[model samples]
Target: MLRAGDTLVIWRLDRLGRSLKDLIAWVGWLKERKIGLRSLHEAMDTTTPAGKLTFHVFGALAEFERARIRDRTQDGLAAVRARSRKGGRRPVLNVDKHALAVKLYNEREMPIVKICRTMELSKPTLYSYVRAANGVTDGPPAT
Candidate 1:
């Protein structure tokens, strides 16, 4: 139960909920009951007008920080792509191994599982090579 004198403490605004709607509802409910809400990390206390303004300012700052982070990450990825540097996981099967696997599978009608076992590869790796040989641009077919 909540009352006017009680204080609701949270580590951070994000820790309270995943969505804006949920956060707004919770904050509104506390405000209606004249209860104070405090965030330790953000130093936001929703009791005085200044505290309320602080909370809103923090929310805006958090949103700005998130956007900046995402922008930086995308820029980093683009730079890597431009340099032709590998971004994600390196394929286990190189060009030679892929050609060999495709040839063995197509000409001999070798079972996929057996081929994977023989090549000491997982099913996904075998599929990736076969897909690459077929001129599929998208990284490996789904296993």
Candidate 2:
């Protein structure tokens, strides 16, 4: 547990806060409680005036870096959208595959396992296709 007049030593300053505003708030809080902050990687100590200034400067730079990263990610996403492309995995079941799975399920010439293996589909998927073909939206049929 941390107490007043205790020093909070950390491996890095970046791990202290999420953003510049957050870091400033934390620094203010520490100051009010008479707690010092020491960052080993940045070699910063908030007990001294110079160390405090350096830490603030580093916090500002970290915030700037994060903003730039956000801008780059947005630009990349916008470019992808402009090309009429979509993200995420492709659908597992399409019209043709759905039709074949339902046909195989209805014929009952093969075991469920064999049908799944032949169609490269899971047993649940095969059953769902059969249900959909039979006009069952979900669950067991009504009484």
Candidate 3:
């Protein structure tokens, strides 16, 4: 819990806020609570008007940098997609394994736990396979 005179010290001003708006809101909140914010790297102390102004300027620049990085990432992804290439982790189970899991789940003869253990899949993964096969059930098909 934070008290009225508590101080928040951070390595850098940029680390304190996700965005400019968030930084402003946080500073306002701390001010209202009579708390001080100090950033070692920036040598900023929010207890003073000059420090608060400096922090806001730094926060805005940080957010601008983040926006640029996001834009660049999106552009790179778009370029990759244009080449008919896909990104992200491949599915753990291939088509045959997925089909077998779905079949076992639809059969409803084996307990869900046993099926998961036999297939080396988690409950959620097994259920997802069943779902992809359109085997909609209110709950697990078997014991």
- Report the lDDT tens digits of candidate 1 across residue range 95-122: 7877888888888688888888888898
Residue range 36-64, candidate 3, lDDT tens digits: 99989888899988998989888888899
Question: What global local distance difference test value does model 3 have?
Answer: 0.83
Q: Which candidate is the best by lDDT?
A: 3
Please identify model 1 stretches exceeding 4 Å from their true place.
Answer: 1-6, 13-26, 29-35, 83-143
Query: What number of clashing residue pairs does each candidate have, in the order they appear?
Result: 0, 0, 0
Model 2 clash pairs are none
Query: Clash pairs of candidate 3?
Result: none
Clashing pairs in 1: none
* TM-score-better candidate, 2 vs 3: 3
Candidate 2 Cα errors over 4 Å, as ranges: 83-143
Report the lDDT tens digits of candidate 2 across residue range 22-140. Answer: 77878888888799999898889999999989899988887887889878988887888899987555756789987987887788888889888888888887887788789876421
lDDT of 2: 0.81
1 or 2: which has the higher lDDT? 2
lDDT, candidates in the order shown:
0.76, 0.81, 0.83
